[model samples]
Target: MRLLLFMLGRSIKPAVLITVFVSVVSCVMLTFCEKGGYVFDKEYDSVFTSLEADTAYDKVSEMADNTRAQNDDLAKRAGDYIAAHTKPGSTPPVLPDGLAGQAVRAAQKGGDSSSAGQSELYEFMGSSLKDGKESEQLIGDKLSGYKRNARRGVTDEYSLALSAVLTRDYEQVLDNQQLADKLYDTRAANTYLEYIENDMLFFVLIFLICFSSFSSERQSRRLSAFAITKAGAGRFIFCRIISAGLVCGVCAVIYCLLQFCVMCLSGGAGCLDMPLQYLKGYALSSYAMSFGGLCIAAVVLRVLLAEVLCAAMLLLSFLSKRNITAGLICLAPTAVMIGLSKSDNSTAQFVTCKFSFLFGGEGYVRVFSTPYPVVWLYVLICAFAAGALFITLIAQGQRREY
Candidate 1:
């Protein structure tokens, strides 16, 4: 315990605090200032310039266009093909590359002429929800860890939770033109799509911070000296993992609180339980959420995820001789996750989304709609990753002399 606290104390040096503070401030300011110069000011103008208004209008129009693009007849057909290909009593088919599109186009011969991408997007989401349940079907047999508990949002038997998800997404995306414009008028001051844009830099910054966990210690050769202090390798690795994770988690909390303070100041923290629309099909969900609820949830999950990832970084340090080598190994994946969240910024810049969408808030509607705190499958992946890395590093550490 003393060793753990000591490690954490070392992790929270002034350098860490200063870097985190500066990074958080820079990101929040960059994002918040772009949203028409802060809405909380009493002297704030209640109008958009001609350019701003035109930008908002074009954004919505482009959103619908993008949705239409992603959800062409081919995508709709592909979704159906994927669904049809599934076997009820067997594992879902893991197809070869482009199989979905191949099957979809092969099956369709030009049926519906005037279709919207929202419909196809809904189909894809429904397929995903079904796929998740099917994947969860092995809980009792092969997968003991994934029991069906309603409190955890898991059910042993199949459930059509996808219907509710589809409905919500549809409602939010099909907003009347008037409401769509109102959502982006820069005066409404809601935690809708535009609000999330202000926090993108903050999230990317968190990803960067997490990527560096243990790099400095490894570079400074402290690990070798620390290993000599009367500790078994297993005990040392375990303590270091915990210590690093805890330190990162605490730092993440500090970052989150800073972002939230900025949110409150800029009027981004207004509604705790208001309906939200991502307004873009590239987003994870088209549904609504308690705007504030989503932010809080995003912050908590993203922060904890950073900790787990940091532990993974520590494990990498044990394997790689160079800190830059270890750091790059971690940074590559963070970059990919961030990239997956990207849409054409030119079109999406005014809409205020893509960040949280990439970070796991896309289907958050259904996650919150349920009474129990169900662990998302992606989260389960993180848990598995954290556990695997910690164990692997511990085993490796055990073979070395302290």
Candidate 2:
């Protein structure tokens, strides 16, 4: 226990420094970074606020109705103009003032001959007419879906308002049963999601702390004295692993808290009660957790994965003759996983990417005809891997020739 405490004390400084550095970088980037047309900006906040105040669903329903009506009216006008102007053997009428007329003129200018101009003009008219009709129909369908959900007591004005803005391009979510039951302005949730999506920083921190755990002692000749007896070597290995685990666990907790504080300061703390599924990219998740619960789960999972990484690094450090060799060996898999994170293959992503579980998705796996969350499956796998690494380290320690 004394040795474990001493080892932990030795790691405290680097662990604290890494945590502080990561916190500063995260804060600076999140605060100063331009969002570049991100949908959930101040405008979205204001719209959500207005919807919350209205509460009666009248404003949003009216907006949907108005948009549908305007699209239909414009489509009718464009169709009428196209019909009258395209009549055979008739003089071209003066173009009317408006977007439809401007579009016709633009199409006319693109053609090289009268027939070509007429053909281009007709094509533009037909496409515009089709687009307008399609848009109006889409709006109608969305509005009707909202009304149906409202009747089923599944959605409220807030859901309708959010659907109008965020789900405009996702026609399929119009009738999603998991649509948020109340107003949850996703600005806060989105901010939190962005923070947890990538864990490369944590990976690097784990590597720095554990890569020298055994190799440094070995280089200093202290490991030779410790490994002179099997019992002594086993005890020493156990202490080192425990100490590394404790340090990594502390670092994970500190980092999670710091980021959570940042999230709170950025106006997301109150949104922790929001449904997890309400967040972007999680619309299909059936987990019955609030955003806060999801954050807690992510923190726990990160700590577990960090411990697994610590064990692997410790094992490599034990085997390597030099600290630098262990560091390079530890980094190889980390780099591969980082590269694989950008891949489009879902299976590869689920296996190699931390974001696959950190940012929850449709993460269910069937076992014995029963469904279980994939995160738990990952936990089990990590447990087995850690055990195997520990066994390998102990066996190697027992056999090492001083």
Which regions of candidate 1 fall more than 4 Å away from where they truly are? 15-19, 22-25, 31-34, 37-161, 164-221, 277-289, 343-375
lDDT of 2 by residue, 1-402 (tens): 777788778778787787778766765665443242132354334444665422323444454455445445656777778777786888766547885554454345333322333333333222312321233244456556756776787654545454443334334333332354455545555656655665456667677677888888887888878777554776777777787778878887887777777676767776687655556556444355667888888788778777777788888888888878888898975676567655667665565535435344445565654545577787788778877887788788767644
lDDT of the structure predicted as candidate 2: 0.62
Please provide, for model 1 over 198-286, each residue's C-alpha lDDT reduced to its tens digit, 9 standing for 90 to 100: 44554455445555555565567766676677885466767877776776677667766665666565555433333333222223333
Sliding window of 10 residues with minimal summed lDDT for model 2: 124-133
Give the alpha-carbon lDDT of every model: 0.49, 0.62
How many residue pairs of model 1 clash at the backbone?
Answer: 3
What are the models' TM-scores? 0.52, 0.67
Can you give the lDDT of residue 85 in candidate 2?
A: 79
